[model samples]
Target: MTAVPVFLYHAVSDNPPRWLAPFTVSPRTFVEHLNMIADSGLRVVPLRQLVTTLLGGPPLPPRSAVLTFDDGYADFASTVAPLLAGRGLPATLYVTTGALHASGTPSGRGPFPSAATLSWGQLRELDAAGFEIGGHTKTHPQLDTLPRTSVREEVGGCKREIEDALGHPVDSFAYPHGYSSRTVRTLVWETGWTSAAAVRGPSALSSNRDDPLRFARLMVRADTDRKRFELWAQGEGAPVAPFAEGLRTRGWRAYRRARAVTGHPYRALPTDEG
Candidate 1:
């Protein structure tokens, strides 16, 4: 069975704020990426549909792939959605509800930069336009560091909020910072989400047999050139899995230990590392 690549993005802008500039892709680059996928004869499907096909609902199309964006950045509505709409592609947007209400401000005293989270109005428009909106917790926090109760609130609360705002069910989730432990996974499952996405680590699932909860995604940052992006689109980007996982595992442990000492689940600073 051939694995489908789930491409992950954060913001789409040529003039991204200082802190998030690394993760943000220019609009031209985004368009090029979309064109690459379309020209590759690959089908760009919704993440939920991809999951269903992977789980036995239907045989996936040849070279099926998924696009997902995290944090519900304003650029998603302004930039990403337009390009996706033009391509007739579907994507999943995972929102941190707290940020939506926080106005145009960075959540903490870090240089994370000030940007507007998507408004309720914008989210509703996206839902109406055939995009899936998933939960990324009430506030973007490291789920592994929080107690189970807080984890439940963060995960469950965000789902309920999106449902209330959109008048539809949210069936998917993506871990903030791509961090989750077994307990966190269980909490997400109990909250009624059918699937969840994580950034980095291993390559994407080669078949339906892979775990649904820990679905791996290829993090596409600003620096991803056309050659590397093509490698990913063609599903030939797994050559560096061992090296990538090694770095991810070490960074995850260090963050876990640091959070343990600070008793803080939320990160105050923006990072170049995904």
Candidate 2:
């Protein structure tokens, strides 16, 4: 079986600066991108299908892919969801449960305006609409910064909340801030999640790796463009698995900025950003 390009998106809009750090893809480009995917012969596979295939589901179509979205942006319903429905494509939305209750400002480094995330009621509708609801975290915390107990809370709590609100079990999990450690992976499994995702590029299923918890993703952020997305979805691009790990040395900007604000060193920060 070929590796599926699990494309991750934040928002979809043509608004100025995109309102998020990576910003949202305008409806035009988004539709064009979907067209590109269709033209390329790739079938949009659901996330659970990918995992089931991993656990012995049958082989997928040659151009099969797993469409996923992180952060549970309200724009998903407002912007992307309608387009996807129009195209008869399936997608999964990994959400931060705590953010579902938030009615205020969005935190983190957003180059675009932070939009409100999906509410639990909205998520229920998404479930009814045939979208898989997965866990990102309880509060979108940088999982590495938190204690193991907190990690469980962030990982496990989100799943529980989604299940409770939607009346369906959320077996999949995406890391908050795309941050995870070996410990975080264990915590996710300990929390009873069937799978977890990271920002690693390409797909693990292409080669059929056994790891269900630490799946890599082509995290489509602000810099990613259409052609690049095509190349990535085809299993060709900078391997983002190592890039995500190297973000530790490379991500000291915010981590260090936070430490500098308090005059301290990065004691707990690790190089293993799984």
**lDDT for each of the candidates?**
0.76, 0.67
- Judged by lDDT against the true structure, how good is candidate 1? 0.76
Q: Could you tell me the TM-score of candidate 2?
A: 0.80
Compose the digit string of candidate 2's lDDT tens values, residues 175-221: 75555667888888888888877754223223244356666766665
RMSD of each: 3.6, 5.0
1-274 in candidate 1: lDDT tens per residue?
5667888888888777787877788888988898898888778877877678646687677688889898877889888888888878889998888777433434332122376567777888899998899988886777777878999999999999999998978899998878777788899999999998875453343334445676777778877888988988888765322123466676775777577768764453322233
| Residue 132 of model 1, lDDT score | 90
Runs in model 2 with CA error above 4 Å?
16-21, 102-114, 201-207, 240-274
- Mark the regions of model 1 whose C-alpha exceeds 4 Å error after superposition: 102-113, 202-207, 239-251, 264-274
Pairs that clash in candidate 2: 2-206, 3-206, 19-112, 19-113, 20-112, 21-111, 22-222, 200-217
Candidate 1, clashing residue pairs? Answer: none
Worst 10 residues of 1 by lDDT: 103-112
